[model samples]
Target: MRDAYHEELDALTDRLVEMTRLVRSAISRATTALLDSDLQLAESVISHDEEVDRIFAEIEASIFDLMARQQPVAVDLRTIVVALRMGTDLERMGDLAEHVAKVARLRHPDSAIPPEIRSTILEMGQIAERLITKTGSCIASRDVESALELEADDDAMDRLHRRLFKILMADDWKYGVEPAIDVTLIGRYYERYADHAVRVAQDVVYLVTGSRTQDADLR
Candidate 1:
């Protein structure tokens, strides 16, 4: 019975890690679709989001069943709690990626990003991919140090986010209002996606160290 119970707990970790992988791919493809204005890729990202949602739902059900039947304690209890939090954040990250894909679909053949801001948006996407990739490593390895490094990558995303606004607000800006709004929303989606990845990493830190970082505390 003990062996079976522990196996269930291990399964929760496996599910969470799987979620990380799905969301990571979602964001990567969404970024490419946004940059290239590929409607097919954007639709793919949007449609595949249901798979990430399904995995998170399973994680929640398993956590509840474990709590009710096994009455997990100590580290096992932490695993359940942290897994719940991580799953929630990963699900949100998937939604954010879908949102980015929707923006690309809305613009169709014309890229949502302007020529002036395209490179910045590209960098933000790259940073987002890097952050989530590291986030997956943290989830699988339970490496607090690697998890903590996600913050710096998130900082880079934020910088690019602010740069987007600066470009939109510049005197030479001539893309007009609709394009500006699209860029703003797209920047926000990337920024929020990175934020959620940071939250997942912070949860990893809490899972291992039992102490929340200052940013995690704010969450």
Candidate 2:
């Protein structure tokens, strides 16, 4: 029975790793679609969101089953709990990617922001993508130190988000209110994606070190 339980746990971890890969791919493709104004790729990302949702449900069911059957304790219990939390974060990240795709589709061939603002938006997307990839690696490797590094990476995203806002709100604005609103919402989607990735890393830290970190300072 113990050996069977171990096998189930390992399977759960493997499924999570797979889910992480899908979420990362969604982020990458969604960002590329936005930057390149590729409606087809953006549509693909939007359609694939259902797969992420399915994986979330699978992970949750597996965790609940393990808890009821094996009655995990100590580190084992922590692993299950952390897996559920990580799944939630990953799902949210996937949803944010879809949101980016929606924005791209809404704008179609033309980008919502001008060239200057588009550049800033691209930079924000890149930072968010990097953090998402690193957070996945930290979780898979169970590297507490690397997880802490992700916190700093998230800080960079926050800085870029604020910078983008400052540019949007400046008195020199020429894009008009509608374009400004689109760009602002896109920046928000990217920022929220990074925020959830940071949360996943924090959950990993809790799993390994048994403690939670400070809440993100949104100011």
Candidate 3:
């Protein structure tokens, strides 16, 4: 019975990793859809978000069942807690990606990003993907050291976000108010997406070392 319980714990980790994969793809596709103004790709990202949600729901159910059936302590308790937090962050990342896709759909053939800010948005998307990829690695390997690196990657995203606002606020900005609003919302989605990825990586640190140093700073 103990063996089965351990397997269940491992399964939770597996599910979390799967969620990372799904959200990573979602962000990547959303970025492309935004850049290319591809309606089909944007629609796909929005619709597939339910799969990520479903996996998170399963993780929550398993964690609850484990808690009910067995008294988790020490590392086991950390595992359950970390899994819950990580699952929540990953689910939010999925939603952020979906939000980006919705913006793309709203604009349809016209790109929401103006030429002046296109490169900055693209870089933000790239950083987001990098952060989520490392987050997945941290969760799968339980590597505290590697998990800590996500903070720096998130810093890059934040820098890009600031740069995006600078461009929008520049005197030469001629896109008018509507496109400016879209750019602002899109930048915010990418920034929040990176933030959630860092949070998940911090959870990996907690899962391995029972430390919340990085997580505390994030809050």
**Candidate 1 lDDT over residue span 80-128, tens digit each:** 9989999999999999999999999999989887889878988988898
lDDT of 3: 0.90
lDDT agreement of model 1 with the native: 0.89
Best by lDDT, which number? 3
What are the per-residue Cα lDDT tens digits for candidate 2 across 1-219? Answer: 568888888787777777777878887888888878899999999999999999899999989989998999989998988889889988998999999888888898987667777777777777887887788787778888887787777788888898888988899988898888888888899899998888888887778877664334211
**TM-score per candidate, in order?**
0.95, 0.93, 0.96
Task: For candidate 2, report its TM-score.
Answer: 0.93
lDDT of 3 by residue, 1-120 (tens): 569889999899899999999999999999999999999999999999999999999999989989988989888988898799999999999999999999999999998878888889
Ranking by lDDT: 3, 1, 2
Q: Compute the lDDT of residue 51 as modeled in candidate 2.
A: 98
Note the residue pairs that clash in candidate 3.
Answer: none
Please list all clashing residue pairs in model 1, or write none if there are none: none
Per-model CA lDDT versus the true structure? 0.89, 0.83, 0.90
After aligning candidate 1 to the native by TM-score, how far in Å is the CA of 11 from where it should be? 1.2
